[model samples]
Target: MSDQPVNLVSVNTAPERAKKVIGTVIENVKDKYTIVHAGNSATIDGVKPLLLSIQPPPGILFCASMWTPEEQAEIQQIARETIPGIRTHAIPTGLQVQVGPDGVIKYLMERIDDIMKV
Candidate 1:
């Protein structure tokens, strides 16, 4: 697969845990993908333009917050308006793992791997 960038959007207040999880996740995927730890933003609008400007755009976006179906659809719609063919996947409540650092890292690795396969 082409080495399209992988964007990770994480927002955590805990320094130590965030460092460990984000650090580990970056280390694990850096060799194979161009990992952009897009950092937290006060609003998506603040980062949207930058993300949309990426050369090939990011192939996958791993969000730390779980959005409800309606919210997920809204985000997907907004993204599709800008980039056709983009898709969004939400992790259900039962399988969230946790909305913490670990969950974000886990989801990033798993989903990116799955997307890379396709």
Candidate 2:
């Protein structure tokens, strides 16, 4: 409340409310410090899209991103064993993926038969 201006930005530490939000980030994000919060609605709005993006999907193709590690053998194993005519390519890290080429195309194409059988 002083008339003299003071830099209060660093004065505050992340509180218990912010602490609670860390649990909600995904397994990947939990390894880093990326939580965002404000004391109000604008803060919540800023973070909504990120939370939505991390939500797990219902099937194989759902795991696609621009790229994930080449070492997610479990997902690949499930795709190969359970789905037909599906193959995976392991592109190197940080190379751009092709447009009009769905990264998870193999998985998506295989989903039709599984979905129909279900």
Scored by TM-score, the top model is 1
Per-residue alpha-carbon lDDT of candidate 1 for residues 6-108, written as tens digits (9 for 90 to 100): 6544322333444466567778877776666555423345335644765565444433344456654555455557655544444443334455556666776
Model 1 regions lying over 4 Å from their true place: 1-24, 38-41, 44-56, 91-99
**TM-score of each model, paired residue for residue:** 0.57, 0.22
Instruction: Determine which window of 10 residues in candidate 2 has minimal summed lDDT.
Output: 4-13
For all candidates in order, the CA lDDT equals: 0.52, 0.28
- Give a tens-digit lDDT track for model 2, residues 60-95: 122222335643344444444544333433332222
